[model samples]
Target: MRSYRAQGPLPGFYHYYPGVPAVVGVRVEERVNFCPAVWNTGLSADPPLFGVSISPKRFTHGLLLKARRFSASFHPFGQKDLVHWLGSHSGREVDKGQAPHFLGHTGVPILEGAYAAYELELLEVHTFGDHDLFVGRVVAVWEEEGLLDEKGRPKPGLALLYYGKGLYGRPAEETFAP
Candidate 1:
């Protein structure tokens, strides 16, 4: 096994760690909910599986489990206000779908400015320590035209990347050349 430098575990260490930020949206009946998530990734290519790790204490957790499906938004950048608003409140108390947010083709709510979105069907749920890992199969996807270039690959610019301690940033504009 390869070994790497170790940083002592600390809360919000993710604030200094670079990672993509994602917003997960789901609706239960007439109520819609949203949450900011960074603990997610594409798990497979053949079956098109993805996974998100959420703490059980979050209201969005129950919603996702009950709904068995959800829409996820991956933003390119510049929506800090909405991200802060959604992350600061609980869905039970606030209706995040009230304005600006809309439902997708799969009936799941999604936020505007999300350059890429995916509607997923829940496949499995497993408890791992303090968080539950949810695996989903992609059923549908919607991406903004600009996100992918003419050849069909992601273009790098203004994509939102987060560091755990309430900080966010975008990739630098071509600081290097081939």
Candidate 2:
């Protein structure tokens, strides 16, 4: 096993990964809700799986515990402001459902204007140190009609990437080079 420590110049720190666009939605009783999440990834192709990490303290976390179904919506670059608004605010104090949202297959609320969205059923839950890892099976997926390119592939707009220290970012034009 490899040992790890958080001290010294080469401390055991994970470099920041580029943020991917995602919106995590869950239903708590009759209320369907969702929040913007940056920590989401595709787990597998065979089982068609995906996963998102949610802090235990988030309102969506409680909702996820109650409802086994959720949706992950990907916003286009144009929706960056909306994603930021949703991420910065708390669901407990705001009613996101009141905003523009559409009902997906699982009855989960999905923002209608997103670039694309996927409905998922919870397959398993793993408790991590400060967040819960939600593994889900993709049940359905759809994309905006005009958002696809000539090859019928999704042409996603700019993505809103997250930086750890309360800062969000978009792609930098000339920062990194191959």
Candidate 3:
């Protein structure tokens, strides 16, 4: 195999695709919005911190800054269309209230039928390049009944994985011990 040398600028940054897409929900006053976030991860174990990076131009960015709270909902692979729709559309244009969701412990909308959902209180906001990383402290979690095994791992459902460029896929159900 051959490798290429570095270039002045990168074409795109999604070589790291196939990550579980998160539907981030935020509400400031009565204005609630939902947006799909493919760039989210756990930041810390202690204090239970999580972070989702959002571009400043996105509507969710401002709402999150004001609300200072959000919910991250993870649906099954079967709901991939919903995930795509949320990402493709803008909250500034669409109502987004038609999506099936309910209020969480902190009053943030949590998507209904999610395999798992997390309610987080905003802890800090860090600016990195064009995106702002909204760091949050996990305050509550909702897990679907019977979805997790005794070890607290999700059973055999396919996870909704984003592959960038409007494509989506899922991991095989087969599991192995490392």
Candidate 4:
């Protein structure tokens, strides 16, 4: 067997590949923006909390702070191209208002083709290193019919998975339960 190690800070350290991609939607009045993010996850179950780590430099960062709410949408693997396109562009330069989206109960934009979406109300912001964690309490949720089983597990659907850099992947077609 062979192994490799790094002692100092690793640049472009995306060793944690294949993360579920989430399109974070934010709106400030008439302006709307969606940022593709992989650094997001469910934080709590009782209070139903979700968090997304975003760099302050991103345009959506300021909008999210001002609006005090946002929506997280998960598109299927077939929409991987759209996900990448949204992430590559910035709201400051490009106007994504024309994108196909509908406002959630909290007024945050939800992608039209998203299989699942969550409307969140901002609860707290924790700064860690280069990014700030925007923690939000899940206020409303929308899920496509027949996507999840009784246990809330996906039923043979391909989820968008990011592999860092400019790559994407999908899970295998096999499922196991014990």
* 1-178 per-residue lDDT for model 3 (tens digits): 8567657555667878878888999998988889989999999999899999999999999999999999998888889888898899999999887888999988999988788899999999999978999999999999986766777556765578888889998878888889
My TM-score estimates for the predictions, one after another, are: 0.87, 0.82, 0.94, 0.93
lDDT (tens digit, per residue) of candidate 2 on 1-178 = 7767756455422266557657887777678677877778999998899999899889988898788889998776677677777888888999876767877877887887776788999999998777788999999987776876665445533455666444666665443337
lDDT of 4 by residue, 45-145 (tens): 98999999999999999999999999999888889888898999999999876788999987899988887889999999999988999999999999886
- Of candidate 3, the 10-residue stretch with the lowest lDDT total is 2-11
Worst 10 residues of 1 by lDDT: 8-17
RMSD to truth, every model: 3.5, 4.5, 1.5, 1.7
TM-score of candidate 1 to 2 decimals: 0.87
Rank candidates, TM-score, best first.
3, 4, 1, 2
Which regions of candidate 2 fall more than 4 Å away from where they truly are? 1-14, 150-157, 172-178
- Candidate 4 local accuracy as lDDT? 0.89
Give lDDT tens digits, candidate 1, residues 105-140. 889888888878888999999998788988989998
lDDT-superior candidate, 2 or 3: 3
Backbone clash pairs for candidate 3 read none
Local distance difference test scores for all models: 0.82, 0.77, 0.88, 0.89
Clashing residue pairs in all predictions, respectively, total 4, 0, 0, 0
TM-score of model number 4? 0.93
Candidate 1: regions farther than 4 A off: 1-12, 151-154, 175-178
Candidate 2: Cα lDDT at 24? 88
Model 1 lDDT vs. the true structure?
A: 0.82
Q: Supply candidate 4's per-residue lDDT for 12.
A: 64
